[model samples]
Target: LNSPESIAVVVAKPIYWLSVALKPIVSFLGISTEFLLKLLGVTVKEEAPVTESEINKMLTEGVAMGAYEEEEPILVENIFHLADMNAGDIMTPRTQLKWIDLNGTEDEIMEVLKNANHYRIPVGTDSLDELKGLVTVS
Candidate 1:
């Protein structure tokens, strides 16, 4: 029990247990620092953050002035909206998927990759019903 591994575990034990113990209390609070300070009878003022439209307007001006060489302005806009999106919300239909078989040989895989445009391809064992997983080609 006095070994290096055991010593490391003992040192980390408090951190793990403390998180487990505090998780519930932390979840219950679910308040800002200002809220906690107010509970303790301290004065705190919180400011509202800048709106998304304001930031987008600034970026639009930057693009209009030719500050960015490429189409970074459009990219920033897409990223801003992408933050509020989920993969499932934008997933292609199963009928329109470009997939490959799991049991395909190297030659078959090479052929598929040669003609394919994407890096990640859905893999299936038998049919699309038995889809194993996705394969990412480097």
Candidate 2:
């Protein structure tokens, strides 16, 4: 109280006295420091950061505990694979692409549609390389 150096005394004295006063009760009840602080109306701020492994562990445990069905992992894997997939990866090769001649008659077009089993067909002039545009049959 006499100098700035008494700040520690100012702070520590109350804590020391409070601890001394609470020791008998805490020891009698065998309460933890955190629980004691909570019982004293003091909120303890804490953080538990979750990692990838922890999430995986929790998911695996959930699967084992029947919280999730067996197909749940498949969905997670498909989600992961989605990021790696590109447009070309899932498209059919050029060799297997179905096309329709621009000069084809209505019967020819219907035949192509019947054989190709597709609602839309790519229109071309003489070959697939001379691509004109898409033809959608509604």
Candidate 3:
């Protein structure tokens, strides 16, 4: 009775009998054995983690299959693309940038900064080409 096979038989016999006994009730209720096990807080299987490439492929396929909204896949794809982007790729062009003039009055600088709605603004001498330093607007 202490042997491994004996122990297995001892442990498996009750489970086999239980399944046999529950089969008819399960059939009557039209529910799967796995579903019943889940209701009993039993996990049947565990899913492995997906890689980034797999996730990107799944998102592409899901969008093509119309399983996801256009915006949803686009957002996920953008996140994937973000890893490949450098600062130059995401930075604002110098022509469109806002800066605080170093020679401007404090009130004028504050007004310009307020209108720009920027947290860290670049401070320059006369133009952007003449770099002074960075100013943190609180």
Using lDDT as the measure, which candidate wins?
A: 3
Tell me how candidate 3 scores on lDDT. Answer: 0.84
Model 3 lDDT tens row, 9-62:
778989999999999998977667667888999876788899887987888889
TM-score of each: 0.41, 0.36, 0.38
Over the stretch 3-96, how does candidate 2's per-residue lDDT look in tens digits? 8677886789899999999999988775677678888999767788976567667778899999998888767767767868997887777788
Model 1, 1-138: lDDT tens digits are: 459988887779898999999998887776666578878998756888988898778878877888764577678779888999998777877887777877778788678777776778888875678888888877
Pairs of residues clashing in candidate 2 = none
- Return the clash pairs for model 3, or none: none
Scanning candidate 2 in windows of ten residues, the lowest lDDT window is 50-59
Q: What is the lDDT of residue 81 in candidate 3?
A: 91
Q: Candidate 1: lDDT of 9?
A: 77
lDDT score at residue 27, model 1, on the 0-100 scale: 76
lDDT of 1: 0.79
| Model 2 residue 104 lDDT score | 76
lDDT per prediction? 0.79, 0.80, 0.84
Candidates 2 and 3 compared by TM-score, better number: 3
